[model samples]
Target: MALSTSNRAAPSSYLSLGEVAAELGITDRTVRNYVARGVLPAHRIKGSRLIRVRRSDVDALLQPVPVTDGGDAA
Candidate 1:
């Protein structure tokens, strides 16, 4: 018998608070604040009190900064 493969992508792994902070170049407290403010979504582990965030969620926080051209205005 041959195994069947699906065209679906694998699920993303969860990230710890520290990991999320490092990824965003921010402090863990900031990450916690984001979670508290409902800006970032977090999940609780099934059997533990530990909380985790998805990489996709972290990536979602990344937004392109608007660049302004240095020009003199009259």
Candidate 2:
């Protein structure tokens, strides 16, 4: 799916945690953990378990994570 550039300034205006995960190519759990660890900010919807993640926050996570070439630990 193509990401809309029309609202680039406000990307997270309507994105959910799941959507963020898809955009970042990560698992939903990882997105949730971000929220848990305070890396990503989220807002709880009234009368619902749904959580919304800001687009800017997700964008920040796109930075490359340092890792070893192999699957071994650094």
Candidate 3:
């Protein structure tokens, strides 16, 4: 008998909960809250609590708000 393996690699978009939290300067609990509130998308691995989020999805949520002229600038 011999062990077998493939050269396939994991998706680049997915990141750990801690990675997302650290990038946002927040805590894991806060990240979990965002997931719970439906503000962010997450997926938990089957048979375990390991959560992963798409980098694109997280980046979308962190996009900077556009500034508009209110005609009141001093």
Winning model by TM-score: 3
What TM-score, over all chains together, does every model reach?
Answer: 0.67, 0.62, 0.69
* Winner by lDDT: 3
Model 1 per-residue lDDT at 44: 67
For the record, the alpha-carbon RMSD of candidate 2 to the native fold, in angstroms, is 9.3
Cα lDDT of model 3 by residue, 6-70, tens digit: 23332667778799999889999998888888788877655565678879978998999898889
- In TM-score terms, candidate 2 sits at 0.62
Tens digit of per-residue lDDT, candidate 1, span 1-74: 11123333324576788999998999999988888888888776555656777788788889676889879877
State the local distance difference test value for candidate 3: 0.75
Model 2: per-residue lDDT, tens digit, 15-59? 787898899899999888877877777766555656776676677
How should the candidates be ordered by TM-score, best one leading? 3, 1, 2
- Which pairs of residues clash in candidate 3, taking residues 3 or more apart in a chain or in different chains? none
